[model samples]
Target chain A: MSTFSKTRPPLLETTRPTADQTVLRVTDLTTGFRRGATTTEVVRGVSFDLRAGRTLVLLGESGCGKSVTARSLMRLTPERAVIGGSVQLGDEELLTLPLADVVRRRGKRIALVPQDPAGALSPLRKIGSQVSEVLRVHGIVGTRQERTGRTLELLDRVGIPDPQRVAGSYAHELSGGMRQRVAIAIAVACDPEVLIADEPTTALDVTVQAQILELFQDLQARLGMATLLVTHDVGVAERMADEIAVMYAGRIVESGLAETVLSAPRHPYTAALLRALPVPGVRRGELQPIPGQPSAPSERPAGCPFRTRCDFQHDACSEYEPPLFVTDVATHAACDLMRPSQQAVG
Target chain B: MAAPEFLLEGRGLTVTYGNGVRAVSDVDLTVRHGEIVGLVGESGCGKSSLANTVLRMVKPQSGTLSFNGKDLLAMHGDELKAVRRSLQVVPQDPSTSLNPRLTIAQSVEFNLKVHGWGRRERRARVMEMLDRVGIPASYSTRYPHQLSGGQLQRVAIARALVTDPSLVVCDEAVSALDKSVQAQILNLLAQLQRDLDVAFLFVSHDLTVVEHVSDRVLVMYLGRIVEEGPATEILTAPRHPYTQALLASIPTRGQQRAAIHGEPPSPVNPPSGCGFRTRCPYAVDACAGYDNTPHAVGPDHAARCVRLDDLALTAPQAWRNS
Candidate 1:
């Protein structure tokens, strides 16, 4: 009855090279912007991998460069910005690829679902035309009839109640949650090997946020696309991430399996952040706020960026930048206290 | 009559906007001295309208409002101005609330100046309040753009409290800041509330934040209070199905996956009886034209439901752990 029921199943064979494998590998990724005379490094020396059907969330607060890092991975940074890193997608390196090649791969190989769907969507165009445009540009489905049918099917798959009506409606005619659903439908139209969702539900309502997250999980399982989610909400990260990489002032302070790092984080920043978050049972006025503001990218201190605010700071924290130390539990933390030579951070 | 126990009280307040939208419909609200009452709901739930009513910003079409044990709606001219000084509000966005041209000290001092404080006294008070909010004396001269979101928020709070208001209404004051920064602002607000003995009408869409800061919680759905009670009681053992659904929708708290679906009914033309009946999971035919009246479930705890007795046997707890 559906457009894809007979010919295709999520375009799986076209995108997936090998099922359930590491499709994208990134290392030492750095992004910097030149303002006036100085170059401020926003994302410095970050490394991680994205596997098929797994989500690796780059979790951090606003100025921590999580968004800039996501932009760097997608090669969506401005022309003035400086980007450096090894980004491996199968046999090719994404960063070193030609401009045309990267453009070709953007929607077909690695698609991006931006934060504000209202802003991301074309206000002038109808919802169906936009999705069909992506399909037409990629040359995936031929003919006007097939494209129209496929757009409706995609919208339906994203959980829009009345796909037929929604296809004819403009972006403004839909709600925040519906606009996001349409954005997802467009992103997954070509069945990219990697999908980068940057704050997909941040602008939406809390209830709507939960529904969108469930859709992301559902689509990932069905399509088996490697997902890289960027969010500041710890709860969203906990809900979606299989592996979590906590970023701080341009660098990843912690990385590991979500279950291990979230439960018992080795980094002081991560521990303080978790405690500071307002969970359900934390009684009134019990939040332990980390003192002082996070350092800007340009104004990072001599050694550790978080030393000025960290409660467990010692002599080593100011003298030498701590490397990511893998604990016995396999969780990695970039802290002097996590070093074998140092005692545990109290 | 005995002296009113509550500092601010509104009886049967109904606020209807010009666009034929009834924002606040027959809402009875109250806040005690030094107590934090959280007004929570999604967009268009009229939580802001209730706060505006308390601030006397919008005149209710039909309601008797009292503040500081005096009639607020009846007061006019200078008397209203003098009384309304004590009803200060911290706006949602700190960046816009503050003047870009003005320095941090100038911004906080501007409020004191309006209340007709002397120049020397205003300068002294601004420094003291800035210190209390964790903004250094040196950074006080910096412009709004020079300060971070958290610092700007502290400046905003200092500005709001500079007049020494009795009831400071924080309208999503921390919603703009990052999580860590939000924590800092929340802690500062709570500490200041106790130190100054000022009641707060904390308004937010975030249930976690509302539960964290509020002593009592008011759940608004389509311009009506669906549930109201002590924070722990309302969030942990919510009697209203709407409150339970909100609790269950929080990913960190209930179900490990959010289940609540569908958009809220339009405020202009809400569902006949229960506004929440459209999205409520346990909605029934009896819910139509059900009056949506409040029934007291405990001390200061009430819920609007026709089947409270039926739900008492089945859904008693908030199901946060579930």
Candidate 2:
């Protein structure tokens, strides 16, 4: 009998947060874009700690400021976006760093794999030149010969077939999966301490997405680097993250261990989201949809940003914003109903 | 159960594009009167091309397609137009489907207008469909840009059903919406299917979504139907190796995951014999030959695999919990 989908050993293992060294710490990050004379805040007071070899996933749907928060960490948002936050990378304050200093540290210290590999890559340059450019900028290799050899090595490591042929071809010539592999090769050329991938697998097909996600997992296991992944896919978060921060309306409504947050989400928004997704073996009529569209930053109310669609509504929710209340061990939820004082009543 | 009456039947459908890409090859499918038939496949597998064939949007190079026992390929002019009225489509993106210049009411009314409904009757029917889909009458005046994705999808559904079509083809209808919002649209489609008793050709790349909504499912791989059976049996105990691999590759809430390497091969130069032979882990020497025989595993379940009888594959524990 074929044992293809049987309960054999897992093909890819989910790495626990084994390393204790805190690599990157972000505190109260707020990002806003200039609209006329006023600034429209997109990311509001987002904070997280990324330990070495751990994956911290910023999870949210569209317009939830998850992407904006990821961009704010690297100062990669558009020119008009005003970022106010303290990003600490191994005793270095990245938010206050000079432009040139940040540029020097981009590939050498932290790397980003964007959502769209096509947009991230240069259409005119060959794939080899792009990988070599990263290595050269970071001063990884001295000679041109070493750079070419290392370029091909990086491509091959990322699971690209026929590195020689792929290196000579332009970005537009490869498939979406191949372009993404080239993008991964470029991002990891310098072996950065911290990696930030924003929706990296959202653009590819399911089979290719599995391969790319496995590449990320394998690289993180081998190199022992910290990853800050931002995505809207629950399946990716379930498979990849050590810790997950559920973002809603520019703030983290829930943060906890990935297993806890996904299986027993405390926040109303978090629970609602899990209920909405279609799962195999789920009995019909169990899909309870969240009532309304996610509110835009401009339309968000003063109190709980998620109260409009939340199933459990309290009168105090309209008066003040809820703080992050500890709901369980290693889990926090920003819900008034989950407060310690109201535990018995609730 | 007694034999079900077929609403649409397609046999030996094959489509070769201008660039000689074999998109849909020798696929046979059927949809009952009010049943939801889900067509599942990944990108480059020609699921969309096969969907287009069923939609009558493309004339296959060699095939016979009939709807309501009427030969679809032989129709011309007024006959095709009359048949076209019954074959409605809901595309992947609602933002692109609805006209930005037209109001929501007019967008839905356009279908009725094309069917030659009177002015007064068109307005009344448009309002009726809008309310049935749970869109407020106040929203009918707003333009497409003003509505949300879920609302716009409801409008698209309303537009499709306003013609009282026999079959509605929804191609990736909920793939664009956020997961939370995607639920609302799926529930809406199921509700409409029950209320209207209309046959729906639900095409999506996600098996999780299809598992609950579909009465029967057709698993396509590399321009062929690898498995066709009841949704429960196909999703839980798929006999085809390709279907098993497809299910395993999806990272789920379960603890297990099987990494299937490589993307789908290019359709322009498909491999010989079994289209999935290149990726099948259990591929045998016999898989290299074209026997083109479907082995039946159950009363109404079948898979086109040479090693179907030798496979005891079950879906992941998460998929078999219930």
Candidate 3:
């Protein structure tokens, strides 16, 4: 009965986007980086779609290619990164866009609210000035005074107390929760169609974490923007996501409605994730952890990425990669055990 | 009933830095022999500061600390050294606390050697402690960097326990490990407490891990304990507004979500009356004028809110749902 694990509802309901609207469409996405003489394929054959106003969570452990997938979508891929994929933001082919165009697209078409807010916000600059700088870079506001006024408004919108005073305070002056609020305000300043939050509240305390998650839920409704929340915490995924895509290595092991996936997960990895939740009332030390560490990009196994750790893995699972199979129109799982005929697809 | 045999006690302890930065207020805590007391709070809640104070790394500005009837604050010279040898710490970050150059066994045995134990005795004790922490003794010759986060933490605990310290302070100890690893370490700590009768000062922001291990919980804010009680009672029916908000904010399995708005107030220039009143939803004008002093609200339950009249001491709706 620790005070830290109590659950709270998402502050709002999911926005009902028109059924035909697809905010993001990613297909056959592959990315790799060179280490000395060898090129390591970090993310291989990744594909998923995010709908307007819906939360599509990329769930996985550290280095499971979750962050790489989100980064590729924004074309924020590093110079060391070599990417091949089809990433379409609405009608625009994001992967094929020019470098200059991609720069323009950042914070305008799509924005990222990074993992560690304390690190993401510049330590040297005042929070308000840092937010205004985003507006200035995007050329959204013409004058400095206008941008300052807008920054104060943004601070107020994010629930910062004494907006004027906070505007003049440096990042060090704010707490972790306040810094996260500043980061959120910056991400939404351009009114982007998509907001990608990478472990936004992982480092925060429970109460502070709840407040930040509520902020995202509130913004998603008011702005009608598609949100991609990336986290490893299943409890967080349950409270925040409209749709969940459980990632393993570099592939989506399971993708389905949040309720369906959480309540009755099909993929082994998804099931393990749900079972691993340290639910109170369940005897302690009974948490069934997903067995092994995620595979390294250079050390990609021959067949199904999860076979080494999967309890139900069979001989065939080590010979060929399992294809993502549709269980329903809206639910898909890439697992040999979940869908035995998965190999027959494509 | 006889009072529980306490291994360590901090009575009216206070630690203050220059510029009037009071890190630990008049705090009282007891770690019963063979029991774990969870000092749970967010960053800057003085959990670390209090731990350092107990270790005598940072001298307290006021109050007394004792271990097994020995006055920790008054002990000096060789007496202090003996006290230090008996009360050890398993710090949160293994990467920083451990020496890279020394092998795990050497690191552990160094403590024994400092206490003037013979080389053979050191080796035997090192192996025994390693086995106790669930680390294979064969891996002892490997350097600290060769170990995983979980393994390194075990080594850290083994090193602390080698000298047979009665009280061990774990500052955010298991927070660095992965979820499964956290469970294993917590289980290991609990098992060690049961078998060895070691008292633990468990400091962490992770409530799940804390509840799983701690017998009693202390909720700290701005260097003061807002509430202290049995884990189940505090978790189920938190009487303080700050405690309620903290409980409501976490996303636990089976619990309903109660989203708190805004972040906690700045500790440096904390608000008048209750430090939590600025963001508290139930705050009235009376709360604005309330003194920043602790008041008893229930048996073993205390809060610093001025709105006890208007304060709806209700169980967090989130927990009820769970």
> What are the TM-scores, per candidate, against the unseen true structure?
0.95, 0.95, 0.89
**What ranking emerges by DockQ with the best candidate at the front?**
1, 2, 3
Backbone clashes for every candidate come to 0, 0, 6
**Model 2 per-residue lDDT tens digits across residues B21-91:** 99999988899999899999988778888889877778899989888888887888898888878889999
lDDT of 3 by residue, B5-94 (tens): 677888888888876777887888778786788888888878789889888898998888888877888889889888877788999999
TM-score of chain B of each: 0.94, 0.95, 0.90
lDDT tens per residue, model 3, A151-262: 8988888878788998999988788888888999899887777889988888887887887787787787777788899998876887888888888888888888887877
Give the range where candidate 3 chain B is weakest over 10 consecutive residues by summed lDDT.
Answer: B313-322
**Highest-scoring model, DockQ:** 1
Give the Å error, residue A202, model 2.
0.8
Least accurate 10 contiguous residues by lDDT in model 2 chain B: B251-260
Candidate 1 per-residue C-alpha lDDT over B203-233 given as tens digits, one digit per residue, 9 for 90 to 100: 9999889988989999998999999999988
Residue A150, model 1: lDDT of 88
Give the local distance difference test score of model 3: 0.79
Error of 2 at B119 (Å): 0.8
Tell me the tens digit of each residue's lDDT in model 2 across A154-247: 8998999899999999998899999999998888887778899999999888877878888898888877779999999988888898999999
- Superposed by TM-score, candidate 1 places the C-alpha of residue A222 at a distance from the truth, in angstroms, of 0.7
The window of 10 residues in a row where model 1 chain B has the poorest summed lDDT is: B313-322
